[model samples]
Target: MRQFFSKCPVCGNCTTVTSYKCKSCGTEIRGEFEPNEFNNLSKEDLEFLRTYLRNRGNLTKVAERFKISYPTAHSYFNRVLAKLGYLQSESFHYAEILEKLEKDQIDFSTALSLIKEEKEVKP
Candidate 1:
């Protein structure tokens, strides 16, 4: 697929969509149109989101699809959620973290750090 740029090529900053055209009729519309939110993500982020959606937002399914650990999959999911403005950096899925802690998959200190780290990420 051809990559559509969401950022200004020269300045490396986000670009505004100023116009649109009809492909078949040659009708044109010009204005400050908002770009698609998905366009803001990179190729990798898009693929991750595709897989995540394909799995119905199941973190375990996403991990299996990616052939990765749950924590790793969770990290990717969280990153995308943050980028899309769907998640606050200071917030987390606490139940999952607590479950890991109860199972001894993560120690108390690591669990605390994980929770703390989320708050440290600027919103």
Candidate 2:
């Protein structure tokens, strides 16, 4: 099955579903319907999100699965986060923390604590 985009490809404008169909009755209805958050993600982004969730949000594992580097995975993850409005660009340095955590210089708890501290210090 093919997927329809939730945003216009040309102008980057948001899209709305305007039709509905009933499988049992073969009836169709049309109206403006808001797309859900999942519908807003592209197929590639959705695949990345699925892999991310499957690996328990571990970017290292996600990178390994995709045969990409950790930084690449971090970039994709950050893009998805921004698309979902959960994060903004330059909001936090995930790649730095991931590198630190991977080198065993700091654990997850310490990394999270440091992130929290950084957020506190930011205006």
Candidate 3:
């Protein structure tokens, strides 16, 4: 089976599921059903989310599993958070934090604490 996309590929607009069918009973239902949050994510994003969760929200483990740098994993995490409407990009200095992390100026725990402090300050 293929993944269901919630956006129109041609026009890049949101698409609604208009119908459903039961394979066992052959019963059909139709409506303008909104896709869930996970449905809005791409396959790669979903995989990243799953890995993050499986790792119990440990970015270091996620990075090792994905064979990416810690900073890159952090960036991917922020991107996912932004996509899910949990973060406002301009509110945090993600680039600076990532750069600092990459340069070994700050550890992961410190970087996370800084981000958490910023979030609390903003909201």
Which numbered prediction scores highest in TM-score against the true structure? 1
Q: Write the per-residue lDDT of candidate 3 for residues 1-123, one digit (tens) a residue.
A: 766988898999988999999999999999989988778888899999999999999999999999998878888888878778787775337756876788899999998998887778775
User: How does model 3 score by TM-score?
Assistant: 0.70
User: Would you estimate the TM-scores of all the predictions?
Assistant: 0.71, 0.62, 0.70
Ranking by TM-score: 1, 3, 2
Per-residue CA lDDT of candidate 2, range 15-72, in tens? 8889988989999999999988788788899999999999999999999999988876
CA shift at 96, candidate 2, in angstroms? 9.5
Looking at candidate 2, the ten consecutive residues that score lowest on lDDT are 88-97
Evaluate model 3: give its lDDT.
Answer: 0.85
Model-by-model lDDT, in order?
Answer: 0.79, 0.82, 0.85
Error of model 3, residue 92, in angstroms: 5.2
- Residue 79 error for model 1, in Å? 0.6
Better of 1 and 3 by TM-score: 1
Model 2 shows how many backbone clashes?
A: 0
Kindly provide the TM-score of model 2 when superposed on the true structure, using C-alpha atoms.
0.62
